[model samples]
Target: MRDRVTEAVPELVAAAVAAPSMHNAQPWRFVHHTESGVLSLYGDPDRTLPVGDPEHRGLHLGCGAGLFNLRVAAAHRGWDAVAETFPDRRDPWRLADVMLEESGTGPSDRALADLFPAVENRHTSRAPFTDEQIPPEIFDELCAAALLEGARLAVPSGWHADDLVDLVHDAELHEAASDLMQAEIIAWTRTGRAGEGPETEGVPAYAFGPRQHDVKVPVRDFGLPRNTERRATATFEERPQLAVLGTEADTPADWLRAGQAMERILLEATRDGLATSMMSQPLEWPELRSMARDPASGLGFVHMVFRLGYGPAAAATPRRPVADVLTVV
Candidate 1:
């Protein structure tokens, strides 16, 4: 195939792995075929939360975000990467395959390359945002970004937003009362003080964001095991901004598209000087997930929930080195 999957692709993989994963598990694996020049992405079964994602939907979303980053990296490098969402019908774990090569001018390439800067800066801001309102134009732009990836961004209105908030609280209560969910949180979070040591993955105690003293913060509280003495309680903003990312279907391919769309929306928001965080608590539960979307909007499947606004950027979480996640054969 003469694909240009060369020695330098690992460096590009660095940017791909930076895409956020559930609990920073970073479950996706990339294998580059030296001779065929085929780079394949697979979801690591070892890194999963069975209780929360028995279907591995969250893992697929993370992998899709990483795949989007890979495409952007390839575009920035002047390489046209041909991607197949699922190359094998029988292999459920295989997520995607990419063949990298040079190509002539294409609008898609330029469009993806343009997002390189946002990809570099997009982050999950667990902190509170100001009560300022986002302009209508920005909302339209975000919706357009999602549409580009074949997904929909639903911005809930007055009553719907309140309904979503209540649903989120209900999901939180469900998780809090469940031992398995709490175990998963404890398994993937660090309890040590901030900057305690070098960690390649997992949500650190520092990123937990201040314990929400106010009842309205949409950010998930990761202090379930309760490290009360070390963590501080900071009042979160009232009337926090929220949105939902959805796909037309609930299949693996749909989840991948949703993930890419989620990242695109987040990057666009970042470029517009907005801080972003995710609230998948409601979406993790089937009953709660269904209630998250507005029946009036007729949105299909809600893949992710976004908290967006003007605020301080959250600290960058650690990611595995490119070598750890990529295998060369």
Candidate 2:
């Protein structure tokens, strides 16, 4: 059974690495033990954003998203995956341990297999969305998707939406002024990494979408410092549709759960004909993060802010090769 599943490790990791990360950093590494029939996921400190993500929250979230993809990919290949996060407290780097056991009860997770296609198709669209409201049923479905992953998806309205945007604006202001944060953005962004260089990671110039001239929700201008891209300014929606994925507690585990829920929501949204992007700016600031969630309810910690609507797909950012991020035993 181990030998059979060992052959699938490369392709499974291939799909897993396709998961989205902050600035396309791809901050994760995997070590699969063929003998034990298990895969261990570790956070790559070298690839992490220290200043921007000092707590390594974002890194954990990215790895969690990758873990979700791995599960989906394995399910699609007819493997039963049992995952345990934070298996060893002493080894903090070991974020998760996933056992790929041969399915005795036949292929499990056929439902998750249905989502395998969306894993690759989903991209963060920074472009303007058409001002069309999603059907009530689809909106409810999106919320349900979050619930499935032990998270809450709050779709703010009226003043709440405005307040969230204000929080984002405040977060953006802080990021711009902070030299450390700016440096991380600079390191990850490129002139044309996708088309040019042998660069396998980081967001490329083309994926920057456009300079948001007038948009309700905030879209980070990754090319603001360069000014060389000559990217055009585009008009976004008056009140852009936004959703917040939150957790009951603010911890590494919550962040991991949020990341998985986030990917589930993004893929479902894409399948429903919605373009999506994530804004973690406000969440970065401890002061502003509380305000990011619904002020009235104050239910959970805002882990990620999502922009969802109809728009062109953002260009695919480069991902690290499977070999670089995964080690097979």
The numbered model that scores best in TM-score is: 1
- How far does residue 94 in candidate 1 sit from its true spot (Å)? 0.9
TM-score of each: 0.95, 0.94
lDDT of 1 at 235: 76
What tens-digit string does per-residue lDDT give for candidate 1 at 143-215? 9999999999989879998988898899989998998998887778876656433477888877888777777
Please list the residue runs of candidate 1 whose C-alpha ends up more than 4 Å from where it truly belongs after superposition.
Answer: 1-4, 193-198
lDDT of each: 0.85, 0.83
Overall local distance difference test of candidate 1: 0.85
Candidate 2 structure quality by residue, lDDT tens digits, 143-250 = 998888888888888898888888888988898899888877878887853443346877777888788876456887788756655788888888888888888898
